[model samples]
Target: MLPVLPLFVLTVILSVVSKPVVIRDSQFNLPVVRKLNFTGESTIPELDRARSQSILKRPTRIVHGDAARAVFDVAATNEALQYVTSVGVGTPPTNYTLIVDTGSANTWLGAMKPYVRTNSSVDTGQQVSMTYPSGSFSGEEFTDRLSLGSFNVTVQGLGVASRSIGFENVDGVLGLGPANLTIGTLFPDTEATIPTVTDTGFAQGVLTAHEVSISFQPTTEEVNVNGVVTFGGNNPSRFNNPISFVPLTATSPSKDFIGINQTITYGTSGFPILANAAGIIDAGTTLLLLATDTLQRYLTVVGGSNEPDPETGFYTISPANFARLQSLFFTIGDTAYEFTANAQIWPRSLNTAIGGNPNTIYLITADLGTRSGSGLDFMNGMVWLERFYFIYDVGAGEVGFATTPFTHATTN
Candidate 1:
């Protein structure tokens, strides 16, 4: 986990920041809609690659889930590094754009934009903060009303930062991770946990179930809102078949998040790359990361080689070898999920955006920094999620996957 500033240090910063506005008889009970943002917007391709690589290098902290009982469309960002949506706070409701992240817990606001204190905002006098590899935000914790779609939460714990680093052009994260990850983010009440919007909604009976389902469609455009996050249950229109439900992995750290156990094989050869390794499904990470050994094996089996682009830190595949590429298979539980040949490569049309030759093909699978057996061996990132329907059931302690229409489509 990303370390937090000591309470004593945080207190000093709070003294100079604005206090929160408090209100009474507040409760939320409506769904919310948020639009997603990609990396290519207002950013050069090189920058997206640099930021992604920087994030990948940091030690990943196992974060824990919450379901947003509302459904909203998601837009593809540059290289699809992140998916963002809009959220409103306060009675008058100031709308802020936020990254929808399931990799870490702790919902906070005000990094690019300052927190707006309205009648529904109540300063808890407790400090809250979270640090990710790409950015960190710290400020006072507050109980406020959050509106998503037609649903709303009467009291939701969110952070208002006084200062931040790394995050740019976004208000802050809307953490859809587990409530346990919020444990140490607040002070004095160190043992107390802040309920995610999903948790509060379920406790208030706003939703019939405590789960969030996500659907992302592959796109050829640089940016498009073609995905949806459904709160409470699966959207029947998103997938055609029954969902394959798999229990969360028993491994520590990895288990703390939406992690699972799966073995990976390459093409029709069925050569094993990762053998039932423990890994996570993350929305925050951009690439499908694998342990170095597994990555090497995958490269060998595909007759591909990784040549790091000095500018972006992402490996590039020669256009020649890309033509001979094949699909990769992820065998999780009783099913084998095929990562099609088209899904294995980044959008060739956007190569120049990431500082690569316009005609070059780049592989989406990259190194996870460490080798297998490190508790976390792989990261099934947004690229992978875009090909499937993912459901994270908080109360049920299970993750479900279904093949979407994009599962084998050559959209890229």
Candidate 2:
């Protein structure tokens, strides 16, 4: 059960990411980022700016039924996430579009939307009803086989949400841990058709996360953003010294949305670098979080001088000390998170000169976030945690952090 006060901190930490351990490089050019001083066309707003303006629309619905399973965080080589997707769960089962979450382990979908089904009630928009404070979700399920890497599972559950909490086009979330929400389990015996995780990819093939072999949708029409997340193997063919890992504390097999002040340790030199760091070892979250004090210190370290933003205090970082050969370490309990030559700093984008100032930044995003209308609502963010393999060991009340095969371009 999620204690009341804990999630409040989690909400703050999960909602705000982008500050932690990081390694910046200016080499290995990638197509993901390209604009230095925005020319004319500017699209989506920066994460800091967007999050500061609103509350998250997370649905904590409990649609208990013999349907749905597995939550995978889908993404492309570009690092852009594939929000909505489809998958089938169970034998003679049903399907749902689950939120591909990296934060929690629960995979719940809207078996029912958040509306009074009256005449004017449209089935679109947000249906996520955060009985707590997150928000509501609206989407459905699809029945299909899933695959990733050399592994595949038939008829697994996945969530697809339409209404988003932060970004403009978000479909849903998929909890990516053992002991998932209502329908998913770590063992096939837990339900029918759900195969043993051992059949997919885990040490000894012993069904590491629940009883099902987590699956992914195949890419086709649109960049399915679909891929496999193998356990016990880091595909040495694809990366360098990829680390071997396991969960933190397993007590939180399901959505281990631990306490907010939970420790996040990175690497083996584990010495709790930052104290009571406000963050989450969320598989669903693709970013790290940092307090304002921490954020500023980091920006300065990355050669940031901090300029003004037309939208208030939000600012972006320029390529000043952009090519430092430094590695960042995150401390959560005894775990440490680090990156090897942090990959793409950011893509150069075009903008319509805000407040008449010619854009002069590279890939740095800045802002003194304000949440819940709190005047001093400035916050930490989720940019730093994007390139690490996080372990939210709920069973141990401790979070673990490991490095990823991260590489960056040593050019501006």
* The best candidate in terms of TM-score: 1
TM-score of 1: 0.83
lDDT for 91 in candidate 2 is: 40
lDDT of each: 0.66, 0.31
Predicted structure 2, TM vs. truth: 0.47
For 1-412, candidate 2 gives per-residue lDDT tens digits of: 0100011101111111222221111112111110111122322234333323322222222111111122222222222322233323344323333334443333434433321222222332222222211333334433333433223454344333434242222223344433222222222233322112222222222222211111222111223232333332222222334343433322211123322343322234443324443333332322233445555555555565565455423345554455552545543444444533332232232222233223454333343343222222222222343354433322223333344443232222
Q: Summarize candidate 1's per-residue lDDT along 1-412 as a digit string, tens digits.
A: 1111110000000011122221111112221222223332222222322323332211212223322233332222332456665778989898886677776557787877888899999999998876654457888999899877555788798899898776666787777776666666788787677766766766665554566677876666666556767665567777867999998877755776677899998878787889988887876666688877888888887766655566555666666677778788999899999999889887777666555677667778777667788877887877888898988876667889999888998877
Q: TM-scores across all candidates?
A: 0.83, 0.47
Least accurate 10 contiguous residues by lDDT in model 2: 1-10
Top candidate when judged by lDDT against the true structure? 1
- Superposed Cα deviation of residue 13, candidate 2 (Å): 28
